[model samples]
Target: MRLLHHSTSTDRPFHLDPAPLVRWVYVGRFSIATAIFVAAVLVWQDALTDTGKLLVASLAFAATLAVTAVSVVYSEFYGRALGPTFHYLQSVFDLFLVTAVVHVTGASSSQFAALYILVIATSSLLLPVGGGLLVAALGNVLYVADALWSVETPFTATVWVQLAVFAAVALGSAWLSAKLREAGKGTEAVLAHVRLQAADILYNIRSGIITVDATGRLLYANPMAEQLLGLDLDPYVGRPVLEALRRIAPELVDAVDRSMRDRVRTARAEGVISAIGRRFPIGVTTTYTEGDGRNTDRTTTAIFQDISDQKRIETLRLRAERLEGVAELSASLAHEIKNPLASIRSACEQLSRSTFTGADERTLTHLVMRESDRLSRLLTEFLDFARVRVARREPIDVAELAAGAVRLALAHPDRPADVSVVCEAPHGEFIVEGDDDLLHRALFNLLLNAVQVSSEGGEVRVEVEDASVKQLDVGPNFADGGVALSVVDTGPGIAPEIRDRLFDPFFTTKPGGSGLGLAVVHRATDVHRGHVFLDTGPTGTRFTIVLPRAARTMPRFTLGTSSATVLT
Candidate 1:
């Protein structure tokens, strides 16, 4: 079967949606008839002289009913030509009906004459500017003719006054209604423009944006979000956010819930999401908006991006940096090995001479053995620095970690008894996510350096502070959260010249140092996505490691023997 389609003019500029106008038109017609019938009843109860007025009222009601039925039929059936033409026809009929009723009752003095204003206002709203003015003029003509041809009242000064008043009301109402219609059209146009611009931006922007209501129901999502999230989101509006995102990223769903439950104003983090049977990196940021007034209606807006490409680029950049470092380290290693090999070769040659005494032979042998051990230690340090990785990450207590590191540093046989090691941390539990053994070795290196550098009887302090309350320059990336672990020592500060190479592999001031301690600390902190900061002054030197917190809160894990791995 073929279906018929009807076009509407309401889509054109300066026209309104006709559905509401049609409804109001029906209501107005019915209400006017009811008012007229009641007025006639009161006149009849008073035993009025003119029975003709009652007849006119009955006729008006019938006419109004007939017109209302015709308009409704045209709107429902024909559908076409249901615009200004229908509205103007209704206005013309109302003018004549109202005039007939007024003439039959009392032309100049009829109370029902005031109903002209209602007709004028409604007609003006429904019609265009010129069409409404035309309607008003026609109603005025009908009213004036009624007053002039009235048989019950003379056309005296009173009639002229009534005519003038009616004309003024009609014209004034028409002007006002026209202005109102223009304003409505202007508002509709502005709203349409804004909506179009908003849609354009939402679709074109690169970042994926999703807006969820207070109950975690999805309200709106742009095309970018659908593409990046790998979901057909057109039909997902009003669905639960978890229902859509659970398969792809349960962790992101949990993050959104946490933001709502905790009432956090803003949060940011990076995670891996599984979508389309593949896992990739994503960076998520949530902004919470609170509703005004007593009944709280909060909205959470989450903006995210597929960062897999960016992460791939970062990996390549880091690999390039490591390759460049390896080249430099190889040169440094060759220079270092040449000196040790030369010392050992010289010692061997001396021992091979027959003129050498027995004591001399023993000294040469001892020199060769020392140089060989030194070479072995250097190679081990290089391996440790190159192999640093954070494989198993878990939450660890800050205080216990600090304590273990300090104990290990103090327990060293070569440690000076005069130097004291202390761990200062808040009484509250502070658990941070990181590789357990890696962090321990990192902290141990910092504490050991502090102890070795401090003068006899000097104090070496390991301080752990929550970054949420304290001052640290980790930048906006970690501004939302983090903890700082710092090792401070009371000793002569590092010289400016040597400070630049403090963390350089194979560069150290100590006589027998392999110089990989600070480098290992640097690598370990980097693996946990943390930063290292160093402050050296005339008083002392301080080394700080700042690490961000994890989403899950795990119990404290004390450092056991397994945690004390030598980076070298």
Candidate 2:
């Protein structure tokens, strides 16, 4: 591959150094010099030894070596200190060397005469336009002068043919060089544009991408990678960053290392990242590319993304499926048992009212009826969870709902007297389109749960936020505009082992808990195309309900028909 150097000077906005190619030219020149001297000594030794032609050949060989040594040192070590003139000098030196070879072998009939064409073509590519033709004319003069001055040299048509060939080759190669140079500039422009586009895409994407070479040098890290990993990666670029990467995202570093070691690609793999004491799931993918023999380096690229929302959505989807099936079965069982339960209660009541009833018989019948009443209440909760749906799409003010729910939840008999509830709704009206009754019930359930879990004198805060107006880390699932209702409590948080089952029907932690509250919350939000998020730790538990798309106007509670009570 050819490397380009950008020039800043207006006199030469661009410069292409032919030093690499020139080095190759030196090799070819040395090989030709060696072959010519060897043939003169081994093949034509006696014929020219006494005539002094062999001595001339020896001097020519010595001059070739001396000129080449100086050219290599000047071009390679000095590094374009003399600019294009340095290249011009090399081309002229090559022409003179070829002329000496033509003189020693045979002036007009020399087989080594074609060496002049080689020098002409090399100078055409190495120098600017007209440089090749300039060298070509000088070579013709040297060749003709040698032929005229030599005693044994014969003037022939071959001399004229050789000169014509040199001129034609010079013109054709120079034109080709000019075209190639123009194409290179156009290609460089296109490459620069493509590089900008790729960089923009990498930095702006939601996922994190990192590229690392086999020796642990960080090749690239995009902006999202820096944010997700919670580190400033710009300074570590083109340097070893594996030590820094290991603290927060060791899994990501390992993925790249495995790819580099195995020379393979991994797709849709699982990884984890932690920052600021919060660890979350991330989906990882990795791939490796082996460098060409010219460069001994292998690169591995790792791409990962925070998948908390995806995992939450998947869990909710699975829980919904399980609850729906359970709800249907519960409804069927309740319907079949309700009829017989009522008959049994009726028979026990009738038996108690008869004259034959003793005190023991009346007590048993009362106990039977009370137990039946409790089971009936439990069945009703099951039906409510199963039948959750958005009965009306009306713009109901959520801030009003939260205030009402907070008041009622705080007043419940289950709440401790000293435990306080604070409702904070920032905007005047945070409106969402859903069944007002369902939204209210779900909001109340979350608040009541928080209140119940709080210690005496602890705080339970209910906040209503318009996510469109606020920047919140609600994950990608709820990235769109929403009205987020958060119920936070200062209680011992829910356990990780039980978090997955928090929304399952009849799953509870209390002594006499009927665990359909969170189930109803999940089902209600699902029907409204919203999401319910649960974040619990040792400090406290936070339950967030995000209802997608807050409404612009209230359809059910219009100002003309009725005055909407934003707060009471």
C-alpha RMSD by candidate, in order: 9.8, 20.1
> Can you list the residue pairs that collide in candidate 1?
none
Per-residue lDDT of model 1, residues 1-568, tens digit only: 0001212223456655666776786787778776767777774564255567777777888888888888878787766556777787887887877786677667867777776777777776677667767776777778777877777677677656656665676667667766766787777777777766766787798988887767777777877888878987766676666667877876567657756766667767566678767888888888877877222267777788888898899899989998999999899899889999999998888777768888988888899999999899889888888889987877888779998988888899767899988899987756778789999999998888888889878999999876532332233345235677889999898887887687788888888788889989988988887778777788788887877755554222222221111111
Error of 1 at 456 (Å): 6.7
Q: Residue 404, candidate 1: how far off, in angstroms?
A: 2.2
Which candidate ranks first by TM-score, i.e. highest? 1
Worst 10 residues of 1 by lDDT: 559-568
CA shift of 392, model 2, Å: 47
Task: Give the local distance difference test score of model 2.
Answer: 0.74
Error of 2 at 402 (Å): 53
Error of model 2, residue 159, in angstroms: 5.3
